[model samples]
Target: MAYRLLALDIDDTLLKSNHRLTKETKEAVEYVKNKGVYITLATGRSFISARKVAKSLKLSDPYLITHNGSFLASHVKEPVFERRIGAETVYQVVDILENYHCHFKLFHEKYVIANKTRQKAQLISRVNLQLTDPLFYPVHYVESPSHRLIDQPLSVLNIRAEFWNKRERRDALEELEESVTGIRITPGGKEELFINHESASKALALQNLASRLGIAPYEIVAVGADMRDRDMVSQAGLGVAMGDAPEEVKASADWITRSNDQSGVAYMVKEVFRKQLRIETPHQ
Candidate 1:
């Protein structure tokens, strides 16, 4: 069966290591888009970060699943669906992170609030120079407890404790998992953790899109890099893992493609829309 929709993961899957779309990828997406296949992005980033990539590709305002599926938008600045952590749960998680001295960033719809000094914020900015447009807004510095202005609906609660050892980080996560209810906790990176509402997973968001488009869950193609991508990858008819993805993530995929820098998105488009893959392959 042909895939009616293509759901792509943004970071480390569609975009190169430099966080930019390659020319080959761009041309391939354009080619397939011309053939009338639906293309959308499912990412761990916020709408702000995801839109930049969408704009670069010149997609016809593709559906956006952002904040690891906590928010879905039809186009930039137009929200279609949103899920948020409970206020009580948010306070509980924040308290736990504070006790463990874990650094974190609270993600609302409009901005990201972090409790760190200007110098530390600048350091983080330097590390993530690709996000030069101020992805994070630092507030007054704090040690044990950190609080910031929460203006809009809270979607994702991101905790970055890379400074701590693996054992310590895991221990803190375990504690949080035990304490928090109605929240989904996933490994964001080697040292970071993401806490969101239980319903705010890529699988749910994909299902929502499928329902809206009158498509089945198995009629879509999903791809990603990190373990956070496991749910959607397993649910898609065609699940692709980036070359640099973890062993678990790779195992969950129907196919493994080259790294993002090698234009893997372009490769998939050609294989699917161009009908280059054999009948036994996932795209078929």
Candidate 2:
């Protein structure tokens, strides 16, 4: 089957252990790109973070479905689609998180608003900066973020906390689910919780993108590694999961490629296009 588009998740799906794109992955992506596949990034990262990885892979004029698909943009420009949580949702979310020992950050199109000016917030910023690639935008620190962010719609609310065990996280997840309306809370990463608008999702965002591009859902391929990636991966005609992906994500995938370190995407891409390439090759 010939897929016209590829929606790739970043983080563990594309980047390897060192949090960098491997040379083999780069060459494979460039090869597929040269063959005219429209490769785009669909990730939980903000636009700034997602765009950096897209450029690193040498994707030209990429369409990014970021902030868990709360925001969509092409070539890092204006959004083709966008979603934001209102102040009420933000305040309610903060209230739930206040009882816990977590550092909360409000995500916007251009800024990361840290909720507390205290030491925990400051420390998380430092740790995140160290863990992440060079930050692309400025983050403002405020003792009370809800007050300042009240009037603005936000891309996401990222909370950083330690996982003493699974139950701590499960309880928090249940609480959020029960307390909120018109909001979505997904805690996939080991130490972070990603919150977005209910209408915002990779599947919904990809549908919008596909409509604008005049592409059918069956003509697209989605590759991802997180639990949050389930929808997009399952919806695509060919859903691929990284070998290291969680069980649930793997269950949703049509096929599982090698681990990210082993160049899973490169492996999957070649296999998917191999048959098409053979058919198109002219007789010598």
Q: List the residue pairs that clash in candidate 1.
A: none
The ten-residue window of minimal lDDT in model 2 covers 275-284
Per-residue alpha-carbon lDDT of candidate 1 for residues 1-284, written as tens digits (9 for 90 to 100): 77777788888888787767788988987776665667788987777777777788887566788888888887545777778886666767777776653456666656665555333454455334323256343232344333432323233433334324577678878898888888888875646777778878887888888777777877788988888888899889888888889999999999888889888878777666686322222220
- Tens digit of per-residue lDDT, candidate 2, span 116-234: 54545445644464233435666777776666656654535333343334676677778889998888777766556778888878988988887777678998889999877999999
Going through the candidates in order, what is the number of backbone clashes in each? 0, 0
TM-score of 2: 0.86
Off by over 4 Å in 2: 75-77, 116-135, 150-167, 278-284
* Global Cα lDDT for candidate 2: 0.75
